[model samples]
Target: MQVHEIQVRSILTRTGGFLREGYSHTLNPYRGCAYGGALCGLPCYAQHSVWITSGRAWGSFLDVKVNAAEVYRSQVNRERRWAATRGGLRIYMSSVTDPYVPQERQYGITRSLLEVMLDEPPERLVLQTHTPYPLWDLERLRALLPLVPDLSVNISIETDRDNLGPGFPPHATPVAERITALESLRKAGIPCVAVVAPMLPIEDPREFARRLGAACDRVVLDHFLLGDGSPGGLRTRRTGFPSKLEEAGWQQWTSLEQFEKVCDIFSEVLGADRVQKSRHGFNTPGPGRCSETTTR
Candidate 1:
């Protein structure tokens, strides 16, 4: 299959309007995604409006957005000029697809993108990924980390039952397996923040938060239920259901009195300084931020 090199110097121009607004720009080396997540259909709303035709749902096909980096450099230059004039880092790696999906391993689009970002002075860079084991090119990430110091790696781990068996396919690995990937990233000094997103239906929600919180530098919470009321909603193998272990009222784990009840769990376990929650405003918003209250 021949890879198409499309030039998009200014990738994320209006992506901020949807979610992950903090990410002003995006650089997807590959067009489609490999994760094939259940909720993957939702966050992709902004992109779907333009690319998707049928509208049933976003398809999973990796069309290497080849010329992505060149255009990205140009956009960065323009954004830098805009930042110098207006002031602000503008851009996000991904809004629709995973920046480091399987296709990245071969084409190395992300690797090349890192080089370009490192060549410059540095700016605000936010990365979101379902897979955490990104050591394919350690030297590059390490080198770029210092230059792009404002980088925030959001590792997406929605629930404890990531193993993908019952309803989930075999392609996706279990959530437990990827948790350590975050640990490896933090150890690499890459500054990882766990995205406890699309919360799944797990055996225990409280313990799930405690465990994932312990691994990453910080935690961002996001609900799994998209609230679209669509059938065949997100599910798992271990529990045969979606994971919402970290949500607000699920299982009544996090006390309603105050957000502190939830924040304190990981804060006390992970560290008062590290553990974060959405309602608290003081803590980081785990991997996912479904709660419209604070995030919106």
Candidate 2:
């Protein structure tokens, strides 16, 4: 992977379109995702964003915002002032790239951003990723709990099966390992959430839901057709994801029928109050808030 240390003019971006509902701003420490070649990136809607990619191949290059923390420190106060007039500031750590990607171990950009947030906490903060790298800052996260009014860690586990067959890029974290990370975060008294986005082929839905119930406070279930951030999943259709699923003999999962079935199964196991769907689920209040089941 080609890594570039570039400086960004801004670290916090105003949320709109897909993320407009719950969050006031979004913070991405990096431009391109290191896991862009991983399993999750196959159907990633972010890859289709030409403005961010700038014609670079997904996963082939990574632009690290070396001064992300500095930029955030400078702009956060002004942004917070602006947000206060409109609504309380709520920041989503990342929307396009994983905050805990592997490069984070060396650069510490995400860690630095969190440190700055410690000094200037937001009304609400959500850290979302599909990797176990968050454990690197467990103590730091614990320190922020009392400081940040609302804080939650969202871990995406798309499927129960660890392997999705050949031709797919290797996952950053295996299924079992990700669940273990969630367990650790929950044990640390951190608010944890399991995001099963674009629900993949699961060997057993009940067991999967049960596992998630034990690991996190609540679960968000979604399918590409409903949650791909496009009208009728137009962007996802442009990828080979559908064909890959079909080749794996899981074509039935390409439709909403299986997704709905899995949602019902999840509700049955995790309780309807704990089960949520798509954008509505993501926009729901942060951890420790009352739970409401979204209509499937």
Candidate 3:
């Protein structure tokens, strides 16, 4: 992969599109993702974002924002001074790239950003990633809990099957590993969310729901049809992802029918109050309402 260490003028972007309703700002530490070649990248919405991709292949390159933390500190401080209210600074850690991608270990960009947040904490902060790398910052997360009123770690586990077979890039973190990471975060007293986003083909919904019910504080169930940002999943449909599922004899998995079935199974196992769907699920009001589930 081509790696470029670059300095960015600003780190916090005003949240827009699908995420604007819940988050005020989005923080992306990098321009490209290391896992862009993996299975999840097949239907990745960010890959289609030309503004971020800059005419480059999704996983072929990574532009590290080496000055992310510094920029964040300056922006947050300036925003706080001019903001009309302090309660509106809800920030999503990442939308375009994984904050804890493999490059994080070497650069510690994500970690540095979190450290900066401890001093200038947002009203709410959501850290989302499919990798288990967050486990490396357990103590840092714990320390930020009291400072940030609505802090949660969202881990995505789209399917039960670890291996999606040939033709797909191998997954960086398997389903089981992500579940284990969720369990560990929950055990550490962190508010944990399991995101089954753009639901993939599952071997058993019941078993999968059971695993998530036990591992996370709540579950966010999503299908590409509803969660892919574009109306009716047009963005995802433009990719070869749908044809791939069909080739695997899992055509049924490509529809909302399976998404609803899995949602029901999750609700049954985790209780209706703990299960949320689509955009509403993602916007579920923070850790304070752990028992509340948004169906709309």
Candidate 4:
């Protein structure tokens, strides 16, 4: 893997495209994801963007935004001054990159940004990752929570079966580890959510939901075809995921029927209020400021 330290003009970006409806802004400390070659990449819509691809294959390289924290401070101060005209900032820690990838242990770019946020908290902040590195800053997250009441930590664990992950992307964290982290965070009194994104084949749906309910406050279920940028999951189809499933005799995993069944089981186990389906979790409104913020 090749790593480059690149300078960026800005850190915070007004959420656009598919994310606009969910978040007001996005702060990606890294340009590309280290999980690029992992199962998560199979359905990642960001990989399809010409801007990120730049003629290079996904997950083969990483560009560290070296000045992310400094840029974020400037953006936050600017936003604070215009708070009256604008609206409370609900920033997603990352959109296209895993904020806590292995490279983070060396550069601490995501950690630095978290420190900045500690001083000036956003109205709502969601820290999403599929790795355990974020646990390194458990105390920091706990401290920042009091300042930012609407903060949430979402761990993206696609399936209970870790074996299936490497078949798609070679480097994703094990599903069990992710669930353990989720349980740890919840135990620490941090608001947590387990995101079964691009919901993969599970050995047992009831057991998965029961485990998730015990680990986190809520659960979100999504299918690759629904979240993929391509309508009807054309992007996933291009990757031959469906064909792979058929060959593996797991063809049922390729259809939305499986996703719907899993959702129903989750609702039964976790309670309908705690189980979120499709894109609903993203659009769910946080307790915002004293005004109605336009999600779009």
Best by lDDT: 2
Candidate 1 overall lDDT versus native: 0.53
Model 2 CA deviation exceeding 4 Å by range: 289-296
- What is the alpha-carbon lDDT for the whole of candidate 3? 0.85
Q: What is the lDDT of residue 265 in candidate 2?
A: 95
The lowest-lDDT stretch of 10 consecutive residues in candidate 2 is 287-296
| Colliding residue pairs in candidate 3 | none
Stretches of candidate 4 off by over 4 Å are 80-87, 165-171, 285-296
lDDT by residue for model 3 over 1-296, one digit each (tens)? 99999999999887778887788788999998999998888888788888888999988889999999999988996665544353478888888899989999999999999999999998888999979889999999989988988999999998898877777777768888899998888878888899998788888899998888888788898988898888778999887798888898889988988789888888888889889999998877665523224221
Model 3 C-alpha RMSD vs. true structure (Å) is 3.1
Total clashing pairs in model 4 = 2
lDDT of 4 by residue, 1-296 (tens): 78999989888888766666666788899888888888777667678777876877888888999998888887787765544244567788788899998999999998998898898888778888988667888888888877885888889988888676334555388788888887788767777788888787899999999998888878888887787657888877877777777777788888888888889999988888888866777656532221112121
| Predicted candidate 2 versus true structure: per-residue lDDT over 24-123, tens digit per residue | 9999888889889889989887898898899998888789999999999999889999889656788998999999889999999999988988998988
Question: In each prediction, how many residue pairs overlap at the backbone (N, C-alpha, C within less than 3 A)?
Answer: 30, 0, 0, 2
Which structure is stronger by TM-score: 2 or 4?
Answer: 2
RMSD of 4: 5.1
- Candidate 1 lDDT over 1-296, as tens digits, reads 22344545445453333333344445566665665444443333323444622343244445676676676676676666655543355455675567877668777788777777777634566667777546565577678666764666667775676443343444244466568877666666666677655444345557877777666666765332222113233222122232333332344322233233444565666665555443231122223311112210
- Residue 147 lDDT (model 2): 89
RMSD in angstroms between candidate 1 and the native structure over all alpha carbons? 7.8
